[model samples]
Target: MMTRRGVQWISSAADDPEECREHWALDPRSPHALPAGRYFDVVAVGQRVGLETFDQLQRHGMPLGPVMADRASEQVGFFLPTWAKSPFDRMVRQETADRAPEYRYLGENSVVVVPGPMPLAGDRYIWLRAPMRRPEASLPRIAALAAMFVAASSVVARADRYGREQSAASVDGGATHAH
Candidate 1:
């Protein structure tokens, strides 16, 4: 449970909490575009993979900062500490060479749309995990995320390989029957 102040700090562009509240009052359903690489960086992954990783994180009792989901885009964004941007980027590049899951690391010069503090009806962006007031208090480290991504990717890759093999076998069986 994040405090209102915490929500304001993370979701609002305004420095003042009161101003943030006023902005929210104007249109609670509307999302706000907050610049990345300032307070935190965003790592976005496919909704399916992200949800799987999120569940694993919870089961392992790992720290999770702030996570937002874009229903329309089918992506989940995990907020990391600003310092993690560079290292995470490097890791992603390396991992991608070996067929990593599709993801985007939004750091400096990137803008992310943050949902309103409270979950309102008809909001496209929703928070899976709210930010803590301390910012880093609940944030997971880059190493942890990297490991989870690798694990998830392996599972997906194996599933894909299995599916392909099954299809090939089915085709071969059908051809044999025809003969």
Candidate 2:
């Protein structure tokens, strides 16, 4: 028999960039300032699993980038099936495997944590897997996550610098040729 699940209704402190930034900073694992620009910050699903994590998040659809964490820390990251073939996938899977068995079970301990500001109203119930306790595990997974984010940041930084340099060069070249 399928067990009935309850929604936890997870809510972000703020949906806007400024508010997100503030809240992100408060998280032990989030960056003080996320990359400046629009990104996929929300995922819509008709039904969600308990305390959505990376694996659960992936069940919905593709997000803009890798699922980092609720905060700046790498303690919580989700894995996408599309990424199943990558080394990162292995890392995520291992982490998921090592988590408490409760997370994988859809018994009683399941609840969905939705954003508080979401316009969702009325009582809607669904089945969800029980969430695993945030285990006190080794830092290796966190280290792996840090490496992934650092590499991503490096790529973005290099791209931004290159773009700026190209823009300046184009402007200078155009001015000289105009004379």
Candidate 3:
């Protein structure tokens, strides 16, 4: 936090000067103030959380941008959230690998912490990064996800066509099953 001319501020306080300058100054609702910054101009399913983020933008008089449903192989079940092959799982693992331990899962002796299996209401959550503040800095991951939708869509389409062809061939042959 900084106080300049008696106006105290709690914004991006990242020790990296440039990072603080780029991300800390903007709130979830601020018009993306960077006239230029490294960013992918696309999005994927997990980025759907932007619905909440953008709502904040609208509430604060900020302009909203285009949002499209992405179709990446990587996003097949991430946001829509099916089990086993969720992209969110792999993404979380990868992030954990790249990050220092958050200890979100650990107790003082490294014991597992649990709020138990009880479902939390609202079924909603947000990923929060700290220090230099922003409601979400998840944009980079979203951009990367836009690439995976293609692979998922390709496999789905091919399976659909194969199923259709098999059905046609089966009908043409007058196949019969007695069970």
- What order do you get sorting by lDDT, best first? 1, 2, 3
The lowest-lDDT stretch of 10 consecutive residues in candidate 1 is 132-141
lDDT of residue 34 for candidate 1: 79
Query: What TM-score would you give candidate 2 relative to the actual structure?
Result: 0.28
What are the per-residue Cα lDDT tens digits for candidate 1 across 1-179? 44666766775543454665777778665677778887778889988778877777777877667788888998889888878866776776565656556788898889898877666545688878876574663324676676677677667677889888788879888443333
Model 1, position 43: C-alpha lDDT score: 89
Arranged by TM-score with the best first, the candidates are 1, 2, 3
Candidate number of the best TM-score: 1
Model 2: per-residue Cα lDDT over 78-107, one tens digit each: 222222224443444454524312212111
Report each candidate's C-alpha RMSD, comma-separated, in the order given. Answer: 3.9, 16.4, 16.9
Task: Report the Cα lDDT for residue 31, model 2.
Answer: 28
* Alpha carbon lDDT at 40, candidate 3: 12
Candidate 2: lDDT of 49?
22
The top-ranked prediction according to lDDT is 1
User: Could you estimate the TM-score for every candidate?
Assistant: 0.78, 0.28, 0.25
lDDT of 1 at 166: 80
